[model samples]
Target: MGRVLFVTPPLTGHVNPAVGVAAALTARGHQVAWAGRPEIIRRLAGDGADVFPCAVPRRLPERDASLKGPAAFRFLWEEFLIPLAEAMAPGVRAAIGRFRPQVVVADQQAIAGGLVADGLGLPWITSATTSAELVDRLAGTPKVAAWLDELLDGLRSRIDGGPADPRMSPHGVLAFTTRELLGPATVPHQVRLVGPSIGGRAPTCDFPWDRLDPAVPTVFVTLGTTNADAAGDFLRAAARGLSRIDGIRTVIADPGRAVGPMGDTVLVVPHVPQMAVLARVDAVVCHGGYNTVCESLWHGVPLVVAPIRDDQPIVAGQVVDAGAGVRLRFGRAKPDRIAAAVTRVLDDPGYRSAAEKVGASFRAAGGAAAAADHLEALLSG
Candidate 1:
């Protein structure tokens, strides 16, 4: 059995996918060590994987805090990536000195892991929960992307002790999304499409899924755990859109600060087992994150994607093109538009039909087990 070191970012979205990969490795009798923030350590420990805390420069920001999207991205780039890489440079050296491993698997957020692997002359592989070129593609938008790129380049220079090189893409990048959504032209040979790595959680929730009224179409709205503040706007739009539809019920997940004021047809809950809710719901209105998108597809539920930040827009576009859903711009999103999109998805059978096909293909791709097998092959070779 080969000893492997896995490093992930502090965010739940980034860390969740890695948990499944680590668990799969452990189940295969390989020794796995995790380097991440405390929360990630706790999560990995809960899954029976050994944990090693790798302190990032700044803790993840509160879910509801208000900051301009660009500014927030800049803050993450500077505080977390730059300083974290500098700090980890030494820690990684020390860790290599102590527990030497054959290979390192790193999430895209933990670029330091790549640097450490490079420094130690070990093989490095990058695992991404979202699209790999998401930031670079978004940077094509005139001043906004340019400004962000400049900031990131500066950070890279500081971390690497010199100017940033344009050839610095991750050594081997693995994306969870499929080729259909990402398009053949967009993905390069270096990036491997491994399908979605949605961990090994059984559908064991005891929620009353059968109780949901079938006569009235159900719409599931979720913004995930980290970004509940964005839910308020989405929920308000959803309530306005679905309020007029007869017998329609909307269930929201993580309605935290957005709970108090809701439409009569909407049910507000702090958390709902997403897969359970999706099993009963006809359509999903979401922020287009990879986990939620994959979950919605895995359940064969069509999507109404309203992407706010990061790679959401790209995912939203993929959904729209694949006939699985429609994409709505967050800034231009309105109640009528949301309602119309939801209605289109629920009323038309084509969307759900297409979604089911994608879901089946995803299932056939072998979920977590296939990913683990791929990792093992890489290690053995």
Candidate 2:
């Protein structure tokens, strides 16, 4: 059996997909382990997982919450990405040495994985959890693009042993999205669309499955785990809007418990088994993170997307462009607006059809199993 090591940051969104891919490899008789935050790996990969400890620095506080465009990109790279790569370098090397993995599957955001593997002359593949980075959000901003290139180049030089292609691996890059949702765009030669790696045993959460009425339309709402925005207002608007609509039941995944108890029509919990909820729900109301977006469509569920920031707007655009969902202004959308969007998606047959269409493409793309095949081919070649 070949040994495989996965390097990823501590984020839930990134680690979850890796769990699926690793599971696929393990099922095929390959030994797989992870190098990341032990807590995150253990939580997602189960308590018995073999995980190498890595030190990730505390995120540098954002100078301003509303920073957008170049400023937002600057804050991400300068304060977080660069520092994260530097902090993770030693651990990445240590993991590689100890594991002696035949191939390293690294998350696109974890630059240390790609660079350190390059440094040590080991084969590696990129595990792209979010498709946001695949599209160029900075098309019109030439200066910002040039500046980012130079910044990344400098970071690569500092890391020093081998060639760096940012988050992508020259050997193979696995993107967990299909072009049917992404729209036509220029992609690097290395990236392969393997659909969303939707595996892993579902997390146990106190979900009211019995209470979910199969009669009325059910909407699952969440801003995702990493969205730092205050969701109380938007979630409240969702509750007010959906509850007022005669037959709709709203389940909001509010981690902060920010939203007050709305009546029996709406369920408010700090968390929900999102995959389980998504399976039963008719539609989704969310912040448009790629994981939620892809997963919802994977289950043939349409959405009412309210993009908060970062690559959210782009993802929302993809949903809209593909006719699978409707987009609303996250900050300014009123209760009525939220209601109307939900109603439209539920009532319109076109949105559901589009969602199912994308789901078909996702299934055909082969997901994690295909990703493993591609990775194994790297070994054979």
Best-fitting candidate, scored by TM-score:
2
User: Could you give candidate 2's per-residue lDDT for residues 251-359 as a string of tens digits?
Assistant: 9888877789888989988888878788999999998998899999999999999987777888899899999999998887788999999999999999999999999
Give the residue spans of candidate 1 off by over 4 A. Answer: 44-47, 58-76, 87-98, 132-171, 201-216, 261-265
Residue 152 lDDT, candidate 1, scale 0-100: 52
Residue 48's lDDT in candidate 2: 79
Q: Candidate 2 overall Cα lDDT vs. reference?
A: 0.86
Provide the clash count, candidate 1: 0
Candidate 1 lDDT tens digits, 3-91 = 87877766777777776777788888988777767555564346455556666555544433345466666665665666666655555
Worst 10 residues of 2 by lDDT: 58-67
After superposition, candidate 2 runs with Cα above 4 Å error: 62-64, 137-140
RMSD (CA, Å), each prediction: 3.8, 1.6
